[model samples]
Target: MNVETTVADSSLLRQRAFVAFWLARTCSSFGFQMFSVAVSWQIYSLTNSALALGMIGLMQFLPSVLLALPAGHLADQFDRRRIVICAQLIEWGALLALVLLTLFSWTDKTALWGLVFVLAVAKALEGPAMTSMLPSLVPPAILARATAANAVGGEAAVIVGPTLGGFLYVAGPDVVYSVSAAFYLLSLVLIGRIRYTRPQQPRLPASLSTLFAGIHFIRARKDVLGVISLDLFAVLLGGATALLPIFAKDILHTGPWGLGMLRGAPSIGALLVGLWLSRNKLEKNVGMIMFGSVAGFGVATLIFALSSQLWLSLLALAALGGFDMVSMVIRGSLVQLDTPDDMRGRVNAVNAIFINTSNQLGEFESGVLAAFMGAVPAAVLGGVGTLVVVGVWMVLFPHLRRRQKLENEAAQE
Candidate 1:
């Protein structure tokens, strides 16, 4: 270990703008997680249909596919901070509407889905601007740490938000919505206080070229393309979490509580690893480390697919999460550092689309595969497929595989 580089204090906490951004992100992420849980429960109660629950996901995903590119263009052409603020305001209003609708018993499944769709639209607009703003908050030297820290906040929210929402739902769905709205309001205040200076650049006219510029730019940079596509395929193929309900019931022979634990295990593992990465930098052979992490993820998933015991399966899932965190930190830092400041928004917008597509489609892919084969075989196939992807990516993007050091890549450019 390099002692000089291993200093746990990366000083990110001392940067006021970065701190504000971090806290604001954490608050909003918590709100979204809690909101998702409450909305699902309420929708199920109202409609009493599993298809209704799936519809909610479709409602949330459609905007990412449809709006992300245009939203990215807006991020590059306009004030990123202002865009984020406006997006959060829209989310806050939607949450407030949910509270009122639930309080008055005016809420129906359709109304719930519509409001959720509105929130998703706001998120689609906010993601690119918010992501592109991170490079400005901290020095380039510690961006990997900053990205890891950001993941820590998000993972923490994922682990706790649903349980908190579930507990608050015992009071009423309105109570949960009210708390979630409060969290969003807090996020709005924090983000509003952040200071940023948008560079002077000629505003380009809206056109097919301007809208698709992010995609074009990404295609020109092999390293960035490799990192982004690697993540897309890794999660796309390694989506074993989608089959947790199946594992909890028939395979693991456990109940709802067991399923909850199984669901939370990966987040717990990711959180722990994220915390570690936030403190320590990957100072050498970062590309190789990233590839290794993905490979480790595949191995963990395979272990999970084969395990019948709940304990062993949980361990495998946790390992999978930890390896994923390592790769996520590397991939996120690489993409941000390699992209120029002027095009960061558009590039990140493209990145967001890939992420959203992978997540939504990964679940769909898992379900279809599981239906054709048994859950174990499908999950086993996913795990093995992830390994194959890593091998092929290494061969396809040789420069990315041989790269060393996170910051050095940007310097060489």
Candidate 2:
């Protein structure tokens, strides 16, 4: 089979709207990581409870689960750009409120919870709009590269944001919050420059029956369901990131900077891999790569849990991130390629919900288990559980591997 290496002559990176959106997302992602670190650190410092930190994750997830479907409907009905702008403004407002609370010496646990709640609300509304708009900016042929580039932008933020946040937190949490607010404001301005026309849809029923369409759409597609479930389980079981603060301060004796490294290491790995994949095409056997990468992620997590040395742990985390990015690129490209234009909003909303649910549920699980078995033991067990889930998934969905080679062959043909 002969494949056209250049499916389209348009350079995705050269597109102005894509560039603006990518830069805006990158900046916002950095701010997002800082906000996450600040909230977790503040809550843990005040209460010294893993449960409290987990509650922060739970608060964020609650709103997303409740609003995601409706938000997706809105994304389908309205101008996505407008939706994104409004969400960014709301997030900016939340950051400002946190900044004020900290500056006025009202940095109590209750105040922190209020801020977390508000940020969660903002993020919940933002998720669907931001995700649904991606396909409009880049052509279909280069969607994988665009996705990889977007992942790189996000991972770069993850790498920089935590390290910067930790240093600023050491100096003063107020400064970190202030900087975060500034980043959101910058994102709002940058988003203003993007000029893509959103797809129009006919008026549809606004009932519960209609709202459940996205779920039904995904349920009927075995491949979609399998991939989504695969991600859900692996992330839910293996993710112990919410407990990093506890491990860094109590177990590792590294403090905030060390905690930042633990947080940023994976993103560093992800960034490198994302950049590499963006240039090279994954034209064949992508499914095997995805499975292997996730298995590697589990192994890295297990290693990180057992290691006491900061550098060793960071190395393990970097490997985890690198592997995870491979899966991300493969899954993301598949989602974009398979979903119809009309269904993109709802499908992507479901995807966002799955991702957030997995992360939040993982956090809750980690927090609860850490309360009983200690963080190290809980994390290690979670990693092993993830590997088990992978094996089970492979047994259940042998088609995923087969489809990888099939898709590549089809593309080449």
Candidate 3:
């Protein structure tokens, strides 16, 4: 009875610190999702240039790449909770700046993207700490379940946030910014309230070696590097998220509301997958599962790229999200489980850079290519590129493919 009870209570929701962290993550995710939608729409409205749309991705990507190592160093050298709290506060202030700018009906569009750049800076700085903080809040036995739960909440936010942002954006950009600011503020408060477990380790000084430690660690670990690189190139080629506004308006002719639904479809699929993962968990052939998922993501993206029917596009996107969730859950668990507490911050920082490449950089790639060849061709070409990446990775990382389970891997020393 005691063992059963203990196992039942192992879920992160039953733990105070994890609950607080979960709330903080969810609220922050919601606000960021809204920011993504609002910014893409606003920028496109201000200037119809596809290249200008690409610039937003570059602006966000540059800060993240530049700050990755420093952010990891900061996370290692400080109380991670405090680092996250400060970042959330900065994010809050950035949203407020957006609110003020929009409310004033400001015509200086450059200033608008400038505030986005500021927000990106804060978020990039905080990424390492936040990723490293998760394991500290829960028992390792149920960490996968906790992560799945977190994904479910995050995916839910992804669904509601963009849809809400779009609907509210129609009311006015002022409304979206104000609400986003409020969510960020709430996340800040929630993170401030949490008390997380901190492992004792040597706090390295802010030197070049200390900053670049994450890079060094990744290079040493082939599995980590392989999975991270696979995701990076796959998403970099396959991602069409940043081009969503163009798809919504130009291809589908459905407007912002359709864009919201399009954006939400993937999250809806991910949410369902996340819930399932929380229950079953993975204990075998994780590598194969992850690779398969990524391939499925590409196939779905290809389908989405070719679809003109709203229903078909939405279904394709949902499949894309579902495939993405499987890999996300599996890879995230592997990263945290395989890494030591001391080095996790740095490793996660590097991981963030790789993952962000697929996201922001991928968006930039889409926009640039869209400007040249047209959106449909750009997306179709990306899907083909993603498939090629999968085939190449299978040959390059045979050990990763042979790995049978997440458990046998040794934690970083």
Candidate 4:
């Protein structure tokens, strides 16, 4: 196929609105990455307490749990575009607060932490609404590909953010926050520039049942529940990333920079795979692919857990990222396309919780297990648990197993 023709045919590249949103996603994600590093370092530098650094994660996580359901309801019942923009503005204000906090050389870190909490709340509201807004930007035919393109950008940002943030931090917290603020500003402008093609829909009043509707919807759909839960349990069990610093220092005999590289390895792997998926379409046996990819992730993590050599460990992490990317693309596409427009926000909010559980809670789980058992053994156990999850998911959710091609299946329906 001609490259130009292919580029021209791609909705993500060809549509100005999508391109703008894609750029906005890139900018905001990048800013968040940089902002997290700046905040963590600032907190540590100020308080000189590891516990203070740990609270950053907790502060960020609480809102995802508390506000997620309500935010999802808001997304469904209001303009998703406006919801995202407004949420972003809230984040921007938080960034501005950080800029001022650092610029003035304030001694009190609690105020800074408070602002971080505000950023957390802003991000919580942003996730569901912004994610649900994408389907409205493109046709059903292009949604899967769009999802792939998105994964590519997101994974890349995940890989780049910390490195960029750490590098910028050397200039001073003021410099780091300032640069991050610029990213947020650009993201806001790009999102604002998009010609809002999405039509407004009638929404339901906010109620207890309305908030619970997303949970009920997922529980009713075995395939959606299976996909979401499988990702949740598998990653929650298999996540070994939190122990990487220990591996770098104690096991591998590598330095702090080595820890950084190890921290980025999985995202780098996912980014490479995501780029490939963006170009090639997944048109056959998607469910099987998802299962196989997740199993591959388990095997890779197992290898990483057991390996002593740095090279082998890095390779295993890469494989883990690659496999997880495949699973992410399939699940993300399915979640967006399978649900109705009115319900997408609620569904995405539930999905966001699963994602947070797998990542944040998974980190907590890994740390706990490592404290009891050795880090190596804890990781090995997680890897084993992941394989077991894939096995169990296959037997339990045959509908997901039989799912051949997502887009084609939609066409058939």
Question: Best-fitting candidate, measured by TM-score?
Answer: 1
Tens-digit lDDT string for candidate 2 (1-413): 23444543334433878889888898899899999989899889889998898788677778888888888777777788888899889888988888888788788877788778877787777777787788888876677888899999887787678879989998778889889989998899989888868556786867786677778877876667777888999998887887899889887899877986787788889998999988888777777777888889899999989998888888998899898898888888777676666777778888888998888788889899999999999999989998898788778777675665313233211
Total clashes, candidate 2?
A: 0
Q: Which scores greater on TM-score, model 1 or model 2? A: 1
The residue-by-residue lDDT of candidate 3 on 59-139, one tens digit each, is 888899889989888988888988888888888898888878878777356887788789889999889999899888877
Name the TM-score of candidate 1: 0.95
Clashing residue pairs in all predictions, respectively, total 0, 0, 0, 0
lDDT of 2 at 114: 78
TM-score of each: 0.95, 0.83, 0.84, 0.93
The true-versus-predicted C-alpha distance at residue 38 of model 1, in Å, is: 1.2
Cα lDDT listed for each candidate: 0.92, 0.82, 0.84, 0.86
Name the better of 1 and 3 by lDDT.
1
**Candidate 1 per-residue C-alpha lDDT over 129-176 given as tens digits, one digit per residue, 9 for 90 to 100:** 999999987888899999999999999999999989999999999999
Higher-ranked by lDDT: 2 or 4: 4
Native RMSD of candidate 4 (Å)? 3.5
